[model samples]
Target: MPLPTGPVIGIMMDNLKKRKSVFPISGRKAVKWSQKLEIPVGGETVLYTGSMYQLLPYMIAAVNRMGKMEDSFLGQYVGLGRFFNKMFNVSSIMFRPKRADHKRFRRIIRDIARLLQQAGVDFGYLYKKELYAGALAFDLGVDETFVAHAQRLSNLFKAQGVRSLITIDPHTTNVLRSVYPTIIDGFDIEVKSYLEVLAENDTLRPINKVEGEITIHDSCVYARYEDVVEQPRQLLRRAGYTVKEPKNNRNLTHCCGGPIESLFPSMAHQIGGKRVQQLKDAQGKGVATMCPICMATLQQAANGDLEIDDIASFLAKAFCPPGANDKSAEEKRSQP
Candidate 1:
């Protein structure tokens, strides 16, 4: 028996309301760390959207959940979910071992900072004052909460004297760039992806060469919707790595199985696996992903067969090579 998408969506909504994340336990820990570091947990962006576009996954899931779904794992998971929901009034939506990890979270943040430093970009963190962009809520069709949250974020930026934002992920980049201006009146905040900022400037030269082909996985939000297709590739090329394209690349790229992961874990895995296979077929030793969700999904799908990293990490290694002196890296940044 296939579980209806409505129920799955309902369950996710319930979980989001209570757990505040599809990956509840991990989300909570990420949130705690975000507070501790004074940086926003990049994934918490869902708590702030009213866009129907963001709800398309649910609509598609609803249609798919109607019959025997394609993936056996998802079918079994859904079956277990129905049993729990019916018997105990408990939903199996909040799965454990969430994609978000505290260590990785910190690493991503630091990687971006290092990437910027290597690029000769002078930037400062809002530190304890940064708020989650509420991307997930916006994606899940919880517009009212998203709007309120957006207003709060806007106010925070103003209060903190933030003139510009350098976002790490596509989700945060999309919400802050495409969504914020429309909802928040008189929105004057300048939002740019860190990749975009680096690409626009030529000051960051790659001193260390990274050898071999690195497959690039474009985030849907980053590529098609936001048209951030070239920035990462430009950075990658500058870093001295040959960029390879899979069957699906750029605007036509396949989903990493992330957007639908929370609602259909097995299906998400299936999609991610297929995409990873496609990248592998391209014969790249490693894959480079720009989005946090894409990085997580593709890495899960790779299962150790291929190396995967966020583009920031790739750039960090290229500019700040492992064996290089930290003082030299800093001195390079300080040069005219």
Candidate 2:
């Protein structure tokens, strides 16, 4: 039997519709990673996280619980959970992500910020004002909800005086750049992925040369939708890491099975496993993923067989100065 997708999607959509996030994470929690960096609140060209990385750990935890129930006798009871979710936030009670997982994802976001700073990019964060880009709702075809959310986000950006956006993840970059303008009138915000920003800055050279070949997992949204295929590669090459291409790469990049994980956990796992194997076939020292979903999904599938990390983690190690990894040290260094 197929998983009960209707109730599952309903739970997620309800969370997004009510909480402004696909998962019910507080805005404070969403922006916690940037606190230590002392990024100013809002600017013309802001670093818009879209809360993708912050929400992934919770999303993954929820999917893991759901996967156990999928296609089994327990799966039928998910509708009951949806019923309670409407009354209260059931996801908060049902899915508690591991502390270590939360820390890892938080570090990835910090690394991204560090990379941007090292590149001499002057950007501010929206902090608690930051909102999820409604990628899941947009992807799942909840048109009404997505449209409303998009309008709200557009209003937030305009009110904050945001002109251009430096997005961290592929989904946010694609939706904010390509989809938002199509749906919302007068949506003129310029969106570019941080990779593109870093790649274009010639002054941001790697201080420590990293010697190893890493396979690149191109995000479908970034590759086909946003033409972000070359930016990450250029940055990686400049960071002194030899880029390896997976069999299905660039425009033909394979899905990490993450987009559908909320609905079909087992199937998504199978797809992730296949993609991991494809990366292994590339025979690189490790795998680098530009998408948060890709990193989470592929890491789960790899199961310690392969080393999988976000592309920013690699760049941060090479480009960021010593003590950049320590929050206190970085805070002191950024103090001017």
Candidate 3:
């Protein structure tokens, strides 16, 4: 059952009113004019349906945990998040595990645990106002559009025999797979961050004949919202590039100001500009990012002062060893 081209708002409201659901429903096209957006694994940016609150459960638990903690630590986490956009991947900063003040990391783990537990108790959470209202009561909120789109995605993927999903970006992954299932029906899908997939595959290659050093910017969605890290650096080393350290990396990775462009423009630009300068400071020759949103931001901010690219783009430029196959590794990289 492929999701509808875009969410059927009428159907959604009807479902809401009736408290019944047609699982794995699709939505109408998000953008009109026969348009599509590119996403990994062949997702064509078509709207899909899922549990009303696949990501809600985590939001709920996290808010509760954070509320029980000191306010200063939470504020500091925000500041550190922006500060960490430089060197390490978002996962490094957010999941450092060693950082004393990383309440979000702890809270995120707890939240996941709670959601998983809830799934065992109930079938799964359904999309509902109760979920949102519950979060708001706790002073937590998420986007309405995202929830709508995510529901369509969960239903779409499930129909495709994808009981487990590896989300490349944290925001989408968490919202679509984590919270909604908790709220809607508690889907049995296994959700893991994309970096974990790469690491699990052990794709890290040895550093060899490499171009000069480069710095990588981890997307906040993966680091903060989702918690992906390390895989990109491993890929860099495998691709024969030396990595440069930036002021901030990992958990504290700076937001590319994407998707959030509606919320803050100048702030995102400032963050991207600062990230580029850090690369220059380290004398790295180029900038690498795992997320397309970050790639666009760095390019706009770098303004061609530096080479900005996504990890996939870089992998496609394989600097192969001499006497390799007649078809150069670069050629093979190009093939895929």
Candidate 4:
């Protein structure tokens, strides 16, 4: 049976066009991770999430449901789903991620922010004003929609007085740093991945001194398009962990099968599983992913056979003091 690529992508583009996010997530939910951190409204340089991490749990849930629908008799209804999605948010109905999943991804975002703060990087958050980078629209080649969205984002930056961006993920970093400039006239935001910022900062050394070996799963956009290959490895090595390289690493990194997961879920899982095997061959304590999609996709493929985490989590564990800025620990402490 043919995958419902057109309908799936159509739904995503519609969401991007209408909601300003790839998923039906509200701006408050998108920016919730930064609330406790008390990040300022705007600054010369801002921490741009692009809603990638916040949207991941929702994306993962939607893809899981889509995979089942595609493999079963329900595949035929996808077109109808897309149609209903236009009138009403069918995605919110069909793709409700688990509470634990939501918390995990949110924690990753907080960890990233905490790591940046620990590194002494002065950055602000746009909060509700930050928009998704239209990565899926660009990846799916929806040029008209993507360009309009990019321009909208550029205008937001211009209005917010944002001169630079510290992006959290590879797709967002690549789009803002590379793609937006090509499409939007006078798009002059200086974008750098948080990894690059931390790697370049000499004062951001690890205080905890973690001991272990972790395999690095390089994001394709980061490694190939943005030259972000070395920054993550450098950060990990600086934290006292032996960086293990899979067979396909750095510029030659294999895809985590996430870009196509929405349209071809099972196929994406298959590709992710293969990549998981390659990482396992490296015989590390765990796998560290720089992209939320990579972490989610490879985790689904690993399914307890391997431990996978976002790179920020490891960095936070090494860089942050015990219980400092730890939301989960605070929550537990407040739980009675």
Candidate 5:
């Protein structure tokens, strides 16, 4: 079904008007925690927050809007005119939006940090300084807002002396690595996905091990656009899972139906369901996703029939080991 055009545009405009994001709460909390710990933020290496943590909220709001619309006059009128080309597009059942699994996003952030620590790649997170990368704005064809956001983000990074950025997700990575350069003159900043950065340091070893056959879902933007197909797989293999390839893998990978989710949820679901079935056809023990949007979209489409995990989470579990926790050895050992 075509997405509810009116509502999607409204949400985008709302996001622009807010000048932040509809889902800044989580990242704001993370920033607060970093401040409490006196963690020095913003230097040569900055941890890019982007919209990975906020993706769930966008999905939640969109799904919620669809729900509220179902019982309104629009739904009744749309049904009455069933003969129209847009008929049968009145239901939000396609997206059984869960409680917006934010805990998972937090875990993904921590996992990235731990992985970086193991790789001996020191970085600082901006926390409060981090801004949404405006990937959604770019994707929705809202160029004016996106360019303005990009300029502001560039200025923020430049002021912070951030020479390099470790992006958390493909969308951010693509926006920073590919899109920004085209629009923002002198966009001299270096952007690397956490996967690319981690992959560069071969000495990084997993302190723990996990056993499973994981089927990988490649992010369309990462794979096709940024050529980030190998870094994730390399990390997963290093984590000790037997990597299984679905028929549509690598550059030929199928989308999890996320890119257009905001504008076309029902069609997104149909596409997502088909991709889920494709992953199931591989019959791997679980499905591993490298993008937050992919994880959220597929998890919903799977409806608990399949286990989905962010690749970073799986790698963190493999490398960090149980009992290691997230603590400095000095602090842990000094505690009675």
Candidate 6:
């Protein structure tokens, strides 16, 4: 049966950017489906604010954009896209809108309009709902928004038929797993991190040995959010590489300062600098993070100081045992 219209499971997502290096193609879809199935997903501020946090995003884009930032080229390219999107929406509003059929999109856009109004965007409220989740925390890096959103999700579990929530990264996972349960009514929903499920299939192991010394940044989300300290370490070790942990490893792991990016881009740098220093201190050749967002954000923040790899990418490129690379294995992974 189709779900009734009102009060559908809420997913507080970040805004969509044209060329995002931080989020993987799969990350957004993975979370989208999770929300569609009644599992709620949330994020920090959906868009880049004009605060210092803008610097990291700008920096990340410059590093990844190759040559888009030079001599007014960026505004010409990105500006035109934003212009067309609004124009398309306005024209659609003047006539018909595909988004009107999408309750989720409608709701998020409304929220975005409100935030913009509060931030004073003077666009006459282009929406009626909060299209993007607000910042998780007000700077200094915290997961308050995730926890609050999850708790809000907890309020709907009975009717939504949602028993579990899943997060793609450690930052989100940590808040959903630990902090949320301790606050509000406590999201009674079971929150699972994606990698744990991905690890369920033994055949899903690495394909080739990732040679060289490697270290895992037990994201605050994975380590503190869900006590996922040992699993990633074990996975990395099994993939035939020595795993070195920073002194402040596990639950005590420091924030990569991603949440602070919006308020203090430089502070985000300071935090990221500390994290990279830890990896360097360990003398590891590369760093692995479970969240694509983390991998991208930290890589940008590190400014090429250390190599950052997502766990999946790390596993995909590394050696796998015999038969693990077979067709049957791939088929099984897509079963759900």
lDDT of each: 0.65, 0.88, 0.43, 0.87, 0.73, 0.43
- lDDT for 15 in candidate 3 is 33
- Tens digits of per-residue lDDT for model 3, 275-326: 7787667677777776544655566577767776555445434422223213
lDDT by residue (33-63, candidate 4, tens digit) is 7767888889989999998999988998898
lDDT of 6 by residue, 223-306 (tens): 764678777776667667888777778889877866544324455667877887877787787887765446545775666667
lDDT over C-alpha atoms for residue 2 of model 5:
46
Q: What is the lDDT of candidate 4?
A: 0.87
Each candidate's TM vs. the true structure? 0.73, 0.95, 0.50, 0.95, 0.84, 0.51
Residue 53 displacement in candidate 1 (angstroms)? 23
Stretches > 4 Å off in candidate 3: 1-148, 202-210, 319-336
Worst 10 residues of 1 by lDDT: 44-53
| Winner of 2 and 3 under TM-score | 2
**Sort order, TM-score high to low:** 4, 2, 5, 1, 6, 3
Residue range 1-336, candidate 1, lDDT tens digits: 334555566554444444443323332333332233223323221112111122222333332343235344565465456446544435323322212233444455566666676666766654334456768778878787678778888887777666777777788888998999999998877788888888998888877767788889889998888999998999899889999999999999989988876566667778989998999998886889887678766776777677887787788778764643222433223211
User: Which 10 residues in a row give candidate 3 its minimum summed lDDT?
Assistant: 29-38
Regions of candidate 1 where Cα sits further than 4 Å from its true position: 1-100, 321-336
Per-residue lDDT, model 3, residue 103, is 26
lDDT of 6: 0.43
| Winner on TM-score (1 vs 2) | 2
How does residue 59 of candidate 2 score in lDDT? 86
Model 1 error, position 56 (Å): 22
Taking all chains together, the TM-score of candidate 1 against the true structure is: 0.73
